[model samples]
Target: MARIKETFDSRAWFMLECDDPDCERRFDDGQWYAYEDDLLADAKDDGWQILYRDEHPELERDMQYCPAHRLPECSTCTNIMADPAGWKDGQCPECIKEEIPNERS
Candidate 1:
């Protein structure tokens, strides 16, 4: 976590620290296991931002990095209404926890 911490609504917010977007592994010998790792990696690359907290000469040593605010759900889950009777689009911890297990390619 960064010193200047803030919360936002985005699916990425639910991600745990150890989760990786570029991991390669096999599961049940079924479909290729890539969606999760890929999504995470892409999000990190696309969302991360670099900033300098100091002025002039001190800028380089006082750099900070953070992620861009993203929607609470991925493109597919963003449309919570898609499953009106099933999942509710809360974007909170509860909602995120439930959705975490269902991410797939």
Candidate 2:
């Protein structure tokens, strides 16, 4: 969970943090907003990314990643991997391994 959502005095307060476990970047508007869209706009203005699901374009992503670690998700399995070497033909190593035949047939 990169963003913290809190309600105070009938208003919303947001504090964003980098999703990467190694990165320690954070953002706080320090002001209450009337609507979620307002806070989201501010978050984007500050370079925070709002990732979405590749398979389901209508569904918004639950997790947020910083500019540095905004890795691509595997097409077969929606997993965000840091190492590019794990990707081949837009699929992760594990997914590719699963496709391989167990025995030479």
Candidate 3:
């Protein structure tokens, strides 16, 4: 099946699928799914299907590794860059460290 609702974390540069009810209405399941392809395999083993893999076309333009976002926490951080120049792009060294909304101008 096609994805239900997907969103850009707006910084980390991955497409988040909002399909699973277990993911706290966000992509929480995928958040901890980093590099653990085994988890994905296990899901398949357990009879779960991968309906779709959501991703940003823009990010693939540079062929970078698109990681899952922290979701509801670190998605909008200005610092989720793949390059050392990430800081220059308004992102912090770690994308999880964004300024609070009220703290910003």
Candidate 4:
């Protein structure tokens, strides 16, 4: 499951963070606006199970992570979302590849 950290900026816009210990992706205007309406819905639809939701009063945002999506139980596989190998430049290379499939035959 992937953990999402939600915080409010000065303008009251929702700021999101991928809270996986190894993941450094943060969601601000670009991600927020694009998935504002379907963030949770899409997550749910993708078979991601929410482990828990926490409210950070000091941060002024709700933080939630889906262990099912970010962290899997496979012994041979590491958390892809975390990108522990540093192969991704703050972006998951595997995820990017999955998003844009290669058309080459």
lDDT of each: 0.34, 0.65, 0.34, 0.40
lDDT digits (tens) for residues 44-99 of candidate 1: 56553323233324343422222432223433444312122333334434445566
Ranking by lDDT: 2, 4, 3, 1
Q: Estimate the lDDT of model 3.
A: 0.34
What are the root-mean-square deviations of the candidates from the true structure over C-alphas?
17.6, 8.0, 15.1, 12.8
After TM-score superposition, the amount by which residue 55's alpha carbon in candidate 3 deviates from its true location, in angstroms, is: 12
Between candidates 1 and 3, which one is better according to TM-score?
Answer: 3
* lDDT leader: 2
Decide which is better by TM-score, 2 or 4.
2
Q: TM-score: which candidate is best?
A: 2
After TM-score superposition, what is the CA distance of residue 95 in candidate 3 from its true location, in Å?
A: 46
**Residue by residue across 48-79, what tens digits does model 2's lDDT show?**
76654673354455566666766676776766
Supply candidate 4's per-residue lDDT for 16: 45
**Alpha carbon lDDT at 4, candidate 2:** 72
**Model 4 TM-score, all chains together:** 0.29
Q: Write out the backbone clash pairs for model 2.
A: none
Task: Give the C-alpha miss distance for residue 23 in model 3, angstroms.
Answer: 8.0
Positional deviation of 12 in candidate 2, in angstroms? Answer: 2.4
Q: On a 0 to 1 TM-score scale, where does candidate 3 land against the true structure?
A: 0.22
Clash count for each candidate, listed in order shown: 5, 0, 3, 10
The stretch of ten residues in a row with the least summed lDDT in candidate 1 is: 24-33
Q: Which ten residues in a row have the lowest lDDT in candidate 4?
A: 74-83
